[model samples]
Structure formats: structure tokens, C-alpha cells
Target chain A: MTMATVQTPPKISAQGVNVFYGDTHAVDNVSLDLYQDEVTALIGPSGCGKSTFLRCLNRMNDTIADCRVSGQILLDDEDIYASQIDVVQLRARVGMVFQKPNPFPKSIYDNVAYGPRIHGLADTREDLDEIVAVSLEKAGLWDEVKDRLDHLGTTLSGGQQQRLCIARAIAIDPEVILMDEPCSALDPIATAKVEALIEELKGGYAIILVTHSMQQAARISQKTAFFHLGQLIEFGDTTQIFTSPTSGRTRDYITGRLV
Target chain B: MTSLPNLKKRWGRPQVQRRLRRRYIYERIFRMLGLAAIGVAGLALATLIVSVGKNAFGGFVQTSIDVDIYLNPEDLRPSSARYRHDFAERVESADMRKLLADALERQFPDIDTDSERRRALQLFSLQARRTLRDYITATPEKIGQTVRMRLLASDDVDQVVKGNIDPRVPESDRRVKDKELAWLAALRADGRISRQLSTTFFTGGDSREPEIAGIFGAIIGSVLTLLVTLLTAFPIGTLAAIYLEEFSPQNRLTAFIEVNINNLAAVPSIVFGLLGLSLFLSILELPRSSPLVGGLTLALMTLPTIIIASRASLRAVPQGLRTAAQGLGASPMQVVFHHVVPSAMPGILTGTIIGLSRGLGETAPLLMIGMVAFVVSTPNALTDAATVLPVQIFLWADSPERAFVEKTSAAILVLLGFLLAVNALAVWLRQRFEVHIPD
Candidate 1:
């Protein structure tokens, strides 16, 4: 594994965050930092709470009716849930993608315009068109879907749909983008395309990705966080986390002895 | 690429053909039975159409004679002495039937004092007398002239053309007395007993006398009630469903509401009628036979349907879409109203329409609130006492007169027409809004 040579304040930070649904504690207390212009990955076995903790970063857990979270989650060094903070505005700053592609049942153009339209980001039609174009280009979906902007978003292929969702997320112009197993549902070729797009996206946006693939974390992440049984076992430079994990659980997870 | 990994490749033969086992004869029988079930449904529909068509077609013909409807100035005024406090009060004591009988005796000397004379007057509908009184009260200027009027005959005369009245049977064997038969014979001799198109059947109010019954008022009542029901129920039910499904947190209170909604759906509509009778008619003191009361009852009936359907539509919107909206920084309200609802509209509309159509045909609940009543004039407002289509049919069905059987069938046809029209609209909207999520 290789390592990146850079130093910057994290774009977001979490401190002792734990998530629970009713009586079930899905994510135990965990802390981590996501830096600007760097790709961070969360990886472990199926029940390691990697996805649960990733959701904690952007407050996606708020959508669950029973899911509750305690502990501070900070964006730009400000408490996200402070009385003065607006969740709507906060979400615009931190976007997300999921394992399964779910595009709005509307045209490709409209899907891209949804977030911007809701938040009043684009003032004119031309401005909206520009956002759509740039976001699609960044997602590597523009060339394939350029001619059919009015076509239904759900009509695209599975891989294309995943990229379309990415484009939609980026169209909101967020500072950080989180992907939860974005390539798990795609084939190898699609995964490689998404991997390349992620590498390019780091230049413009901070990224916190959750995946079950160790090789993928090794291939794309600058810093890696390993979770096991609802705990953040270890987090550091991606190479060190893989080669010299400080915790036994982290080492066990890396070597496939525990998850 | 894949140089060392490109291992061995051997051509494999196609797998052996499996044995073809024949299915049991019972399988074929069950399949045929399924088709037969569809046939049974078709047969039921056909039978209903045929029966209603035969009966309703009989109601449009008039069996009455043209008689002189005089505004006998002296008879209409009732001596002018002991009158003039109010025209209605003055006219209330005036009798149109006595005037008609006296005119008949004076006009036709051949008619005797026996059943023969009485049978001759039987052709005139009892309601025709009320019409005469109303006409004079509305227009008092027709005071000395003998205005000609088309009078509706009795139900027995209607039976003659409809095949219920037998000409061969002796007077002693039939309901009509012997002398009345003589009057009918005389009318037949004079060609006064004729069958003409009964346009009044569609204009008059429902009555115990089948010959005078009309469904116009009831049809209008149903339309007005439905307008009120849809306007109120759809918005409230859909909004409640959206809030509960999309915004409300998981809690005991919301769950209690969810359970209550389900239970309310199963509650009898007559119970709703009781509620409306208590709440709107008595408690609120809205007028009886008013569309307002009917509408309130039907709205209660339709609320559960709309809520269930709207929730299903909301649930149909994948969680990923909401996440997508929130991912883009959309507020919870924006996510629901903008994307979730639009996707769910097709289902919501379909469910709403079905609920409305069911409301339209409902009878028991409306009956409980005094919607089934005899009203002669069309109501100008919801507060006016009026009857709906089903209530009109119910009124006519209970009439002992032979013609009411046909009137009931005609009213049924009109109600069915309304249901069909509403159902068609539902189907069209459902198709228009359906968004098939592709695999």
C-alpha cells in the first residue's frame, strides 16, 4: 500500500458519536476526522457499523423514525445540530450516495435540478444547465447522457443510474461527498470507472466512503478508518492502518480473522 | 489482461432433456374453473342489465287523459269572504279534486254515480290535483278560463300497457271494480286512454305514486353531496397520510392514530350516518335532507380509504428518493411535496376516485339522515331537504303501485350511470399518473 503526503484541517469531525434504533445500539461511540481534498474510507465486515457511522457524518440518520444519535458532529468546527444551524443548509454542504441507485422518477435534467431548485441555488435556467453539465462531467456520466437530458432518469442502466445519482449529489454543490458502497452493486468495469471518478473528485471535494472491499480502500483512500462491532477500532494513514494497525481488532479485520 | 488467468476451456454438451411429466387432469379442471368464474361474473352483469332495461323502459310512457283544468274564479277564491289573510292560507282550504269531480259530472252526463264514474277519474294522478293548486297559486290571472291539462292516470291503467292489467279477466277477479271497468271501456271507446312519452317522470319529485315519480332531484342531490365530500375528504385525508408516513416520528401516539385509521375503515357507513345525524344534523343543526349532512357522512366514509391509499403511495416512494432529496439539502417538507408526492399521485388519485364512487352509491348511511324523502321542487342549496339517487330508488321500490316497480329500475339505471362515469375518470387519472419503476 502507498501513502499520501499532505496536511490540512479536517473538513468535518465527529466526537464520541453513537447511533441507536430503539433498544438496538447499531454504532457505539466512535470519533474520526474527514479532511478537505482527501478521500477517506471506512471498511470492515458486514456488521462492522461502517455504513452506520458514515451516515452519522451527514446526519442521514435523522430520516429514520426510530434511530437516535448522541454526541457532537461538527462541520467546519461548528456543531451541526445547534439551534441556529439549519439542517437543510448543512445537507447542501455534505452530500451522500448509497449502495443502490435511486434516481427520481423524472427526466435526467429535472433530477439534477431538484436539489438546486429546492435550495434556490441556480438563479436562472442557464445557471441550472451549467450545474447539470459540470456535475455530470464530474460523475463521468455526461458523455453518455448528454443528448437525452429530458429522458427519464430511471431509464438508465444500473451503472449509469449509480453515476447519475452521484451527479445529482454533486449538483447540490456540497463541500464533502459521502459514498456508502457506491460500487458494490456495479460490475468490475463500472467499479473501476467510479474509482477513477472518485480519485478525480478529491481535487474538488472531501470524500468519506464506506465499503466492504479492503483493496478498494487501499486503492483510493488517503486515510482509512476501520470499524468493528459498532466501534472505530483504528483510523490513520491508509497504509499504516493496513500494515501496522495499533488495535488487535483492527489487525484481525484486515487479515480476515475478525469483522 | 488475463494472460495467466486464462485457464482451460473445454466444450461442454447440452444437458440431457428432462422427462416430460403430464400434469393431472385436476390442473386443467381448475384452470377451466378460473375461466368459468369470469364467465359467471359476466353473466351476472348481463342479467342485471337485461332486467333493469326491461323494467326502466316501461316507466317513460304516460297513461292519462287531457282534461279541462279550469281556474274556476269563484271556486279558486272560496267565496272571497273568510279569505285574504294569506293567499296560501286562503288557497289551502280550496279543493281541486272536488272541482275536478264536479266538472266531470257536469261535462259528461253519460257517467253514472257508480264505480264507473270513479274509474274514469282514476286515470288522473292524485298529484295532478296538487299541480293544479300550485299553478293557480303561482299564477292567479288564469281565473275564468278553462285551461286544458294533461292528467296522469292511476297505476292500474299503467298495468294495462305494462302487461299487468288483464283485459280478459272479469271485473270480479281483478282489483278494478266492475263499474270502473265500464269507465275504462268508455275511455277506450273514446280513444282517451292513450300512452304518450312521460317527460314529467324525469322532472317530478319522487312519490308513492309511481306515475308521478322523478329522479331529477335525487340526481342533483347526489352530485352536490359528492362535491362537498370530495372537496373536504381528499385534502384532509391525503395531508394526514403524507404527514404520518413522511414526517411523523415513530411513537406511540402516531401508532395509535394508525390503528384507529385502520379500524375506522372497517366501521359501518351507517355508523357514520349516525355520527353525521348527531354532529351535523342535530348538534350543528344543519337542515335535514340537506347535502351538507350527506356530504359530512360520506367524507367520514372516504377518509380512511384516502389515508390508506395515500400512505401506500408514500411508501411506494423508495427510501432512496428521500435520501437523495435530503442528500441535496432539501427540507423534509420539500422532499415529500416535491418528489415523494408527485411519484405517489397516481395511486392517491385512483384510491380517491374509488372511494368517491363508493360514496356516491352508498344508501344506508344517507337514509339514516333523512335523505330519502318526498320533495317536489329542486333545492337551491345544501341546506334544502333533498333525496339522492339511491334514496329515490328506495322510495319508488316501496310503492305499492305497479308503475313504481319500473320507476325504481329507472332510478337504478341513473345511479349506475353516475358510478360508471366516476369510475372512468378514476381509471383515466390512474393511467395518466402511473410511474412504472423499471428493473
Candidate 2:
């Protein structure tokens, strides 16, 4: 497996990022660059700081009282950690899906329309309906939920709820989508559906997926980074990371020997 | 034969048999103890209800004696022609006791002696003269006409008729004399008496005479006070809860506030009354014995309850909803009001209702603020002199009249009924508004 190099400038660049929870350093300094329309998968064992790094991309760590992040993360040459950058606007441009299907306790239509309404992406009810329909269709959920748009989002099955959350995220037209094990709570069939959805979503958004399943990272992501003990060990093409990793630690993790 | 051998072998283990027997016996004892505890509580509640109901039943039906009153125009007119402007003023200025005694003497011809006349007058309520005066003042043209009015009987007569006082008891021991008993029996036999609903109990104001006294003023005072408490406590408690749970930084100061709020709930309610007296009355100089003062005191007492309950409900709301709203770029305020608050509303309201009920039952704080005063008129405004139901019960229970014992019990039942309504509303709101999410 060989690395496929792209000369275009990176969409999001992180340099020497470190995260701390109180006195415990949860995530050590790491540097990486992600390009537009690419799926970058962060693979690690439990508590290996993959999810923490993903949260830092959108400033989600700010919600935790003791969590402290020290790093320089730039989106389109603008530092996101700058004092003038509002967290609300930062989250609007970088949407997130949690490990569990955390749909809002609202009607399906309302759930999908929430982001667009709050962001004022739609000016009228018709515009909102159109955005909701298009977003749901994009998430591959419109056909299953079209007849019952008013049904509560929580009443749906696990797979449909996850897709509904994806639809909700996409309704705001975010540039970056962060998934923290979005399919961990689903069955095999649901996982496959989410994987296909993520693959299709990479065409328009820079997607960063944190997954425990090595096979999922190889199948969906173009680039893969292996993390161990709060530190990034190796990063390269997904095929090279899976078939022939440069670092012995990454090789041991890929082979399920050092989990 | 093989199965029998295995069963015998298993049963032969001493440890297993002893453990099984001990567990069975322990289970039986635990079940019996639980049942006994429940039975004790149920019996206690039943005994209280029966005792209160028995005493209150008689209060619902009051005894009245019919009397024919004649208001002479000469007696009603000013004696020296001082020229009173209105009939109401003249009625107020006239000697009602003399007018009523003259009219009542016509009903009893044998009461020529002063002692007999006094005994006959003892059958009528002390407030009977005022009732006649009010009737005359209302209809001035009715003077000189014989108007038959059903007036409230005296406490002794009311008790005797209600079987609370035994007429067969010794004359010295019982308050009702033999002559009064005989007159009561004769009045009953002559169809000059009636037992009807105590409509006056729901309409009349507080009086020194228990037979004429009513809880109407206290009910109004309680309603007005509760309205003030709800308006003051609900919003403040909810906002405080939201700030503490959703917005406050987790530091020593916030932890101190949280712990103090919980401790405030456990503080004895009487201390709040003292606080109200000193803060609202002495320092603020609000009017004494008014619902405004009483309600403010009760609100202060209710605040801790509401805040604690609201915080619990706010904490009960799923953290996932807040994350979801925030993930969608909603500000912290939007996350709370649009998502967390809506999801926590049923719980918040249930807590608020419970707090309001506690305020309704509280008497000490209000008494500290001078709500124990005898309020003769229903309060027309927040600043008017007023009392609450529990204080009304305290006052009635302190009265020397036997009839007031029944009135006190009846007032307690009224208070319980109101509390039941409020709790029922809380349950209905929980059923209608609370969302049950599957895990």
C-alpha cells in the first residue's frame, strides 16, 4: 500500500495540540492536517484520546468545567481558539454526532428543522420544509420517515434515530462533520448503513471519524491515524496503516495484539 | 428410585436445609412487618379523618330559631330630631339590643320576670341584634311590619340540639339550664326551630360568637396569600434553579449555595416567620395583619422548597438534550429555555405545587406577621387585614364555646380539601406533560 499525496492546502490544520482535565493530561501534543472532501479516521483503544481530539476540533471540550485545551487549530487560515471566535459560530460550521444516537426529544420534522431554524438558514416554513426534506434525503432517511414527520424522533429505531441525527447535523450545511463512534450503538446492518452514509457524506464535508473497529476505518476512511496512550503513533494511507504500518505500536494495534 | 435417592441426598445437606428454612422464615417475618407498618399508618390516617369528620358534620348543619321582629318608626327615628342623613346611619346609631329584646318578649308572654326574660334572650345569638339591624338598614320600608327571620341559635342551644351537650347532665355541670332546655324542647315541638346548612359559615366574617362566625375571610386571605407566593416564588425559584444547575461555574461558592439551599429546606418553618416579622414588618414596615405581609412571609418560607425541588427536576432532565442543542450552535440560554426547561417543566411545576401546598398549611410564619388577628371582613385588597385557614383553626380551637370545636375540625377539612385539589393538579400535569423516554 502506497500513500496518495495531495498538493492542495489543508482545510483544517492542528499544531502541537494538548488537552488536560484538571491535573491529568488526557491528550498529548499531536499535529495533523485534514483536507476537504476527505474522510480521516482516528483509531484507538478505549481512553486513547481519539474522541477528545475530535471534540477539540469544534471546541466541545469547553463545556467541561475542568477540561483545558492548549493548541493552535486553524480553519481556513483562521485560528479557532482566538478570543474573537464565538463558540456558537464555531459549532455551527463544525457539526457533531455522538457515540449514541442522541436525537432531540422532538418530532422528526422538528428535529431536522431545529438547526436550520436556529441558524436562520430558512426564511419561511416552505423553505424549512424544503431544507428538512433535502437533508433527510441526503442522510438516506426521507423514504422511511416521510409519512410520519410529526412522530417523535426518539420513537424511531436505533438506526433511524442515528440517521435522523445525521440529517439534523447536515440541515445546517456545516463544512466539517465530526463523528465520535457514531455507529457503536448500532447492529451490524445499521453500522453498514451508517458507513455508507458517511462515505457518501465525504463528497461535500471534511469528515473526521473516531472508531474502535479497525475494519471500519480501512473500509471508509482515506487516511487513518493510530493513537496509543494519548499519543498519535503513526498516520498515513488507510491501506498502509492496515497492511504495513511503519511503527511497531501501530502494527501491534492493527493486529489486535496490544489492545 | 434414582430420583428419590438424589432428592434425599440433596435434602440431607444440613447447611442447605438450614439456609433455605432460615430464608423462608426471614421472608415471612419481613412481609408481616411490612404489612403491619402499612396497617398502622392507614389506621392512624383513618382515625384522624373519622374524628375530624364527626366533629365537622354538625358544623355543616346549624340550628336556628324563628323570631318575628317589629321595627317601630318612632324607635328608629332620632330621639331629639338631630336629623340623621340616611336610614343606615340611624340604624347604626339605634340601640339594637333594646329593639330586639322588645320584639322577642312578644314571642314569650310567660317571660314577665327579668330572670325568665334573660333566659329567653339567652336562646338567641349575641349577633342576632346586629343581624336585625342590618335587615332594617337594608329595607327601611319594612319598619312597622312583622318580619319573621330565622336567626342563629346560641352556642349552648346549638350544642344541646347537636347532642354534644347532654341535657340530662346535672344542671350545675352543664352550661344549658333546665329552663333553657325546656324552652328549646318546646320550641322544637312547636316547629319554631329548623336545622339547615350553615351557609353563613361560607359567607359570614369572623365573629366573637362561634355560631355566627365563618371562615370566608380566612379563605379569601389564604387565596390572596397563595397567589402572592406563587407569583413571587415560582419564577424566582425556577430561575435560581436554572442558574445553579445549568449556568453556575462549579466552584466552592456554587457548592456553598447548593448546600445552603438544601439546608434551608430542612430549617424549622417558625424561623422563617421570625425572619418575616423582622425583615418584612420591622425593617420594611409593610402593613401588619395584611395578606401582602403574610404572603411575603410565606413566599420566603416557600422559596427554599421550590428551589430545591426545581433543582432536582432540572437535574433530572437528560444531559443529552443540552448537548444536542449546544451541538446545533444554540447558546446556553437557548439550550436551557428551549430544551432543558421544556423537558423539566412537569417536574418543576410538580415541585412548585408541593411548595405551594406547604405554604398553604404553614401557620407560624403568618402568625408572626400578625395574621392571627380577628379579621371581621373579607379582604378587598392585598393590604387589607386578613388571616389564613390554619390560623383560623388555631383561633377557633382556642375559643371557650363548645361549638367552636366543631368549627375548627370543619376548617381543617376545608384546608385538606384544597391541598388534595392542588396535589391532584400536580399529578394530572405530570401525566399530561411529562415525556417518558426509553433508555
Best-performing candidate as measured by TM-score: 2
* Candidate 1 to truth, TM: 0.82
User: A90-180, model 1: which lDDT tens digit per residue?
Assistant: 8889999989888888999998888888888899999999999998998999999999999999999888998999999998888999999
The candidate scoring highest on DockQ is 2
Give the alpha carbon lDDT tens digit for every residue of A187-212 in model 2: 99999999999999998899999999
Model-by-model DockQ, in order:
0.56, 0.64
Error of 1 at A46 (Å): 0.9
Per model, how many backbone clashes are there?
A: 1, 0
lDDT, candidates in the order shown: 0.83, 0.89
Worst 10 residues of 2 chain A by lDDT: A1-10
Error of 2 at A38 (Å): 1.6
The pairs that clash in candidate 1 are: B123-B153
- lDDT of candidate 2 over B246-347, digit per residue (tens): 988889999999889889988888899999999988999999999898888888888888888888888888777877888889999989988888888898
